[model samples]
Target chain A: MDINGPVESTVIEERPGRRRLPPQERRQQIIDGAVAFFAEVGFDGKTRDLAKRLGVTQSLLFNYFATKDELIEAVYEQVYLNRLAPDWPDRLTDRSTPLRDRLLAFYTEYSTLIFQYEWMRIFMSSGLSGAELNRRYLKHLGDVILRPLLGEIEFAARSGGTPTMEDIWNLHGGIVYIGIRQHIYRTPCPDDPSVAITRAVDRFLLAFGVEQG
Target chain B: MDINGPVESTVIEERPGRRRLPPQERRQQIIDGAVAFFAEVGFDGKTRDLAKRLGVTQSLLFNYFATKDELIEAVYEQVYLNRLAPDWPDRLTDRSTPLRDRLLAFYTEYSTLIFQYEWMRIFMSSGLSGAELNRRYLKHLGDVILRPLLGEIEFAARSGGTPTMEDIWNLHGGIVYIGIRQHIYRTPCPDDPSVAITRAVDRFLLAFGVEQG
Candidate 1:
């Protein structure tokens, strides 16, 4: 339960000796370390401590990223942006696929990327600390994912009026909350979340008057 | 934004003069300040700093609550446990009213209590810091609210299979996510969340084969 301790076994460990890594590999290693470090502690964690944890000299750490803010930007990209699958939007909007099927597939894939200790902890920490990462990420999610998904819902609705962005957000949020329960609150969640996700997508489609197979 | 700075105008400020308060009043006052303090700075914030903010000697603060853990327990009571409407469990099972109506009403009432800067932020911080508060609160929530709601769904179902605990969690988590969006992600949420809550409840009811009125 030590928040600052290395809790996640997935976090890349420091090499025992000074085995030389390529500049690109070293930079990625530093960003990965920063992601884990910031996830464990808040953003107020010192870079010197981060360097020590990475087993790199502070100056060498600075060589990769000039300032703490710059390092944080890389962490944001590595943790948040990098995980977003580029084809998700296309697959979500693909008219060939049934809306329920698309939603089920999308959420199943999405949960796998997000339902991690590092991702969830870092996200909660950033939001608590008033960092721009969550806001920016959510904005992007709405723009690329939720908004388009809303359009798909509207297209697929059989009757009972058009769905709004908020409805789509409701579906999205409900799915995300499963991850929150597991990672943030450390509650027991289903080993495979697909069953829950399937139910949610079915409920959402039903609400919008879409027929279920 | 300055996380440490006074962001919330609602935080009770220290009085200028040395006006003594009754033991009961002083104790409540410290709990209020501690809630705000921890919400802003997380539990790792120093007691010395908290006493300084409260305009009390550290000794005086300790007189009310002997240890930081005791002070935090008071905070958990004040911020979370105290907010639970004692009548909620009974009212949620009140089958006289339709299940959808009960859910909408319950979530509306619950959202008002939880959808605040202090409540949401403190809850997230506690979770991230590995405090037992979030875990304990969620267990209480499931027992008092979600389980009973699931039973109500099964009783009201017109046909389809009985709803499960996971289904109830979907409905609950979806409703709570509106508050999370507003407070945690600092996103623009509907000014009134009832519309969204109603939709989620209706969707849940529909999925369970309960006819909507």
Candidate 2:
């Protein structure tokens, strides 16, 4: 059972001999194509279009991506920039900054990136929660920063207990989900001018004992 | 100049018989049908299907919705529950429990509704942000919540202590923009594990001074 791209439709399935490129190049092609496509057409955006962008047969495309899911995973891997996290392990040693400000730096940078790549929300909302690629991507996130950042993230999740990988995951998702609704979904809200991301961070920090003022 | 549902293409028109039914009933009918259609078929779902569900013809669908824009407005009206927030000015003063608990209640209820109507994200991620429906809906929100909560929200905007309506609107859009990224775009973090709504709330709270542990 090989993972695939776009689930039902793989463009390059039959074009095995179309070209010979480095694995890195081919993978980048798929990632670049998927991001641009999603940015424009969103989740329902097609794979054939990606083939068109690459100027190759659908089979050749399939040879690289296998399925849209695979392609999306590749896109997630390529585009996500977690290496940029404000040194969660040691940034706060500078006790001069308020705890809230330090937390905001981490959050603002993360949310800014997320907000900048608007199509990222569409990718997650595409009912692909069950996909192996998405799961792996999430697993990577857990391994990278969350397991070690309990004390820091405590200001966000609101509970002092060491958060499990899943708790951390859900906490982040909860923030992103509501943010999508308020901003992307254009859902209404009270005079509370805070965006979903800001709101999530606000609650998260409060949960962790960050002073609201 | 005519906008009709783009069941197959970019949606551009509305249901044809809007004026035939009484205004309230007609509005309700269209809202119910549109929400169902978006939920069942997603952003690309057919408006014809919505009419069929209502036991109406494709052309008759235009009666209730004159253009695709009109129908989307109906969907926004139903799905965007922010208008309901001001019903509880008491929200700001609810000491029955901690502010955290009250806010969690607000965030949970709001996030749950969005989750159930997953299309809420799709409808937004469609990149049809420039539509009149979107503007009208936001204006309505200002009327219901922002106008009344203007003073507090203005201060929240950090707008130099005195701001105008446009300033508040800009700040609000920024926050909502975050929601769009996390929930609608579903950007994955390296550490996130599950797809819960609390994370969104926490982020929202952090953006403002509402939540504190």
Candidate 3:
């Protein structure tokens, strides 16, 4: 919850007069430390070092997380997977609103979440590790987000209907690519992200031959 | 260079009877090892571990490269910067070539070079490290490649003129995103990269109101 500097592992140790945290709180503490540590040192960072950061012994760290893989998964869950909006799938399919409005709304929220320094760094760390997490995460995005949006665009466009999967990826991937250039690779963009998102969505609509009133 | 497994640090050790490589060859060997090692474990990987992998003493490692930052710079040179085709900017602006043809020609070669497992992995690792290398690399891409292409597109389109910087980045970033999804994130992409590149170029041309006769 504290989005400050790296979680200090020495906090508990420094305060010799303090009582031990409840198990759930302690677990959350370890996860916080892991996120900051992994972001700083990367995923191949040592478990012993992580325990040291947490001011806990390696054995205690292992007791909470059976393995490094488990701890990494917790990072993915905390940072990547669980950030998805609970109602995104429903909003993505909501036919009452025009498809464009829903898209702009969804991406605005999604980008705001993903474009942070912490999120992008950890996401890149997991990716560079050759882990399956990113693949699985992108597939989830395709299934829950992209494919359904494709279906909606088809319904809305009517005569222009059923854009090829290639087009679908190009359109959607273009927006995500924008975030990556800015957030991950730190390319300077002339437009604000909101402006960039709007332009990207407009470009996609044009490229797909979706007519606007 | 052996394109297989992480460049083994034990390469010299494994060849017990082989004579030592000359100084230049030795530096190149260390650079190669750093590329492979950093690509696998990221830039935060320990110098001592890299020395162990290289079958060299830590002192020897430092002698060749004064610091880890210098080693990382060597990696950016070898894996990222040096891969840029020298004539690419010229090719991008050669007016005799049709705009679409020129665009496709450049990206196909660029993607083929950059989409390698090592290239993408090291790229993502550098970006994750919060180092300025990726930003500098992306800026080079924008300056040398994207901005020049935008000028050519404007000249070719004449009356329609150029689109905004937002559009240029969207078009260029869209194609690079495909590479990131496939090579770095391991997303399943059924189209060969060349096919995908062609499609992206076609869509960009269409979106920017560039006519292809």
Candidate 4:
């Protein structure tokens, strides 16, 4: 099984020149490169190849991150976790604004964030990794993201009853499905996120008897 | 680096005995095993390992399927292409049945077919394969499955204009998303597929102003 190949000769040949940068810039660059690489090759990708892609020695890449597991965790944080801005939950539940407008706006932004090729690739990769990264993310979504949105919807609907998680999932899942169809399956969604969100919100409002303008 | 390991020594050790079978039976067995294996480890899994799992010689496995590529195509055919019954399209458009009933029944059956761990895992694996298997499957789904369902919906609704593919995608995508969340993401859907399909169909009917009992 040992074909005594050059240490990743192909990766080295592609990018012969290496740049010297400050540690902060170098770390960011590594994370960015890792995002694209891991999205393409998944968690099983060789760190040496990733180092080669960065035009750095593998040991030098390890200087910035202690291990491959750490690098992948960084990828999860950078691509999936960090993409959620601090103001998102606040913007979603801001009762001062119209519920319909907030719903449409929040999901439009959320869809835009998650539907990118990099995010979806990494998402599918993590799901396939058996590492429960997606499960952990979904828990975070339920607690930090969807719960607040549902609370706002419940408050706005004024239906005098708390909506079940299933109800919220039905609504939010419809929006997420749009991304899956467009990004994952490569289906060209005729409506942009704005249109899709509005339609989903309209259907949800109609189905749940939530009044809206 | 040459350790000189036996040809798949570990896999062979896992199952020391091999069974000899007729060509047709062996071929089907290998395809079936490959579906479960690929669904589990994805396309990157080793053929020798799959042979071990089936208790067959690696060369014998290769004899049944010329290569890993052929084995995966066999997987796509077995898991996806062949699963759709011929009566599905007719059932979707069967005006003799109520449109709501037909939509719910069709989706319930479709969801049942695809929501299994094998089907969902393989589907996600294909999506992440970068081979556009999902796109190919989506095209198959669009042409063979969703289009006729939409035509039936429009006919039943008596909507003067044809519904665009996007409109149909919205309705159908929501149902598919339910499967993704529950099956792929391991989200425990509170309602069964029938309940979820009924709810989605209800929203769709509401959106299109279709009358439902």
Candidate 5:
């Protein structure tokens, strides 16, 4: 059966010329399109529609992704995993820089990546759909990002008591909420989130009995 | 054409002998079921499926709610608007209580209402689907809840600077993220969030140079 019949009239035919591209470039293009498409519609969107939007035949689209799940997996990697800076863990725990400056810098970079319309919508969509994407990303965030920050806070504290994981998550959540407000809730947020991020980080350090250096 | 035909076999026939409920009671029942249903399947779910789940005929479901949008509006009222305590604003700005204590009390009560699985999931689903429900509720929340709390903070600040809406949003978002982690991310959170709430409120006050009296 021809699942991809005539293209829907609503879909704009952007690729009228249909210029041939290299295999790797074509694969990257599909993944980028999938990220935007899945963000607009939830993951439940049909592959036929995606093919139509991409101006590709369903069979050709299937050449790269055999299943919708495979396509979604690629979207997950491009949208979520690839955005995590590898050296973020290292930079977060660098004792030479004050924890305050490190936090500001890290969140500045992190927010720039995750605060996009597509990223925020996809994250919310996955969570609502009960997909494993959010669970996995959050787990990775805890292990790679929050855990290292927690260790830094524990090292920096002037008082004897150790900081808990919840403390680190609170600071992270506070910073991330700025993006959530902008993209998810569609509310007014600061044009630049550094001000809010700085306040949250400073308050977190103060609560931990760490004086600003 | 009857939209709802025979009951699906997969749906457990709990109401073998449907006991007739009074008009108001039946309306409440449908709204309650809808809150759960939409939270699970999202607002895009069909009325036929909702009737099947509720063990009611589609005609019966339509009697109370003329259209799916109407039903969704009712669900919005039940799940979102009804949860806001009217006196919360008054209590938050009572001034008799210390700002820290007031914040702790407000969030403790606020989280209790919003931290439930149904509430969290529905909130997320609505936001992702681009429904007006979240935007409206958040606006109401800003006016009725956050505005009062912001006024209280500004009143209590020992320093000259007045707190911005972003400041209050950060504190609220940090406290609310505990629930989002539990319900949205399906992660373990503190059994009692009050401890975390207390810590957050104290830190917020500390940032403003308000002594914890």
Candidate 6:
């Protein structure tokens, strides 16, 4: 257990000889590096390795962010913000549209973002520790990002076919997870994913009072 | 990567002070340790680590099996075969019942097992890399398993509602991954997972043409 190892400051801090960019660019570079790292290798991938990838010293890396965990939080926040764009959500206050259709659009957009980013597996995996982690993640999601979306969704008029916000969340979460299992894990699927997703979505819409489109 | 480590012995040869046990008991012991370890730390947990936990050296631990990966696979197959006992696939063929109801019951059981067994995440996450992995996982869950249960599901009766076998495979793959995300990654859900599973089950049953109970 006590095999002597290299100091972890080298692990968390940036290495020497890397170029210094402006704060905005530097932060973005770090975020991009982090996303690729987390997506390919998961949280256990070393920060020193990340710094090396950017040709920077660990010390320089720490100058921008004190620790690896803090860097992870920042990456997560950035992704969450990108997902909760103000305009799309703000415009969702159309009470005239059916909530189910609105939510379907939202799920499509959200799922697309998750698929595009591809780092959700890492962020979401790290959140499984306990209630505290779950709550913190949710607080970030619900309070900062999803709340407005929920508000807009709620603002939509419930026709005889509209799904409630709760139902949208339920069905959306379920279906998205299903898609991840198939495409991400490459689990054996009897049907094509698009077909399965359509069916699952149809069922969710059915519960929300809409007949399948 | 080229650096050589310890030269592990390939042969299952007699070592000094080696104690012998009945083959059945020995296999059971190995399987139990594997299940416990896999449940707690997942497949990435080292076989060497498992040896330490079992109070055996690497050589002794490996005396029972050729390699670590094989040991893990053995444990997975053992747990799966043991845990998923009879009365399950029966409903798949209960032709008198609606297919949707059968599907719902299967969904319920599937969700319940993943939630109940801590090692299933390991089993599923490993399936991502290749079709062989998914094939092995799905072969056990094939039509033979479903024929009895699906008999009551009224799926065949609903010509418009029944998803083809390929459709079922895709849907199963998707849902399984989602369940693993919930299991491994702990993705946030808007509703309680159990409740969502129930809702999804109902929706699946509805699609299968079962009269919702």
List iRMS for all predictions. 1.4, 8.0, 2.1, 1.8, 1.3, 4.8
Off by over 4 Å in 4: A1-18, A57-59, A158-163, B1-16, B158-163
Highest DockQ: give the candidate number: 1
Residues B52-148 of candidate 5 have per-residue lDDT tens digits of 8888887899899998899998997887767888888888888887777877778888889889989998888878777787888889999999988
Scored against the true structure, residue B62 in model 2 reaches a CA lDDT of: 77
Chain B TM per candidate, please? 0.83, 0.46, 0.81, 0.81, 0.83, 0.64
A183: Cα error in model 6, Å: 4.6
Off by over 4 Å in 6: A1-27, A46-81, A86-93, A127-135, A138-170, A187-199, A211-213, B1-27, B46-70, B80-90, B124-135, B138-182, B185-199, B207-213
Clashing pairs in 3: A9-A53, B9-B53
Residue lDDT tens for model 4, A1-213: 333366644434444456678999989999999999888777788888988877788898788888889999999888876766788888888888887888888887888888787898788777776658688888888888789887876776654345566667767776777777665666667556667677767767766567778
Clash pairs, candidate 4, are: none
Q: How would you encode candidate 2's per-residue C-alpha lDDT over A5-73 as one tens digit per residue?
A: 567454546545457789788767767777776655555667787777777666776777778777776
- Using all chains and alpha carbons, the TM-scores for the candidates as numbered come to 0.85, 0.50, 0.80, 0.84, 0.87, 0.65
Model 6, span B1-213: residue lDDT tens: 232337745543433345677877867787788787776665567878887776666677677788887787787676666545467666556657655566667666766676544545555445432325545655666655643333444434453355555434434544454454456545543334545555555555555655755
Docking quality (DockQ) for each candidate: 0.55, 0.07, 0.47, 0.38, 0.53, 0.15
Question: What docking class should model 2 receive?
Answer: incorrect
Error of 3 at A28 (Å): 2.2
Candidate 2 lDDT (Cα, 0 to 1): 0.53
- Steric clash pairs (candidate 1): none
Using lDDT as the yardstick, the better of models 3 and 5 is 5
lDDT of 2 by residue, B33-104 (tens): 777677455555677777777766677667667887678766766666453455444663346565546545
Error of 2 at B148 (Å): 3.2
In model 5, which runs have C-alpha deviations exceeding 4 angstroms? A1-24, A57-64, A159-162, B1-20, B46-48, B57-64
**Candidate 1 chain A: minimum summed lDDT over ten consecutive residues — where?**
A1-10
Ranking by TM-score: 5, 1, 4, 3, 6, 2
Q: Report the alpha-carbon TM-score of model 6 versus the true structure.
A: 0.65
User: Which candidate number maximizes lDDT?
Assistant: 1
Instruction: State in Å the error of residue A57, model 6.
Output: 7.3
Q: After aligning candidate 2 to the native by TM-score, how far in Å is the CA of A52 from where it should be? A: 3.5
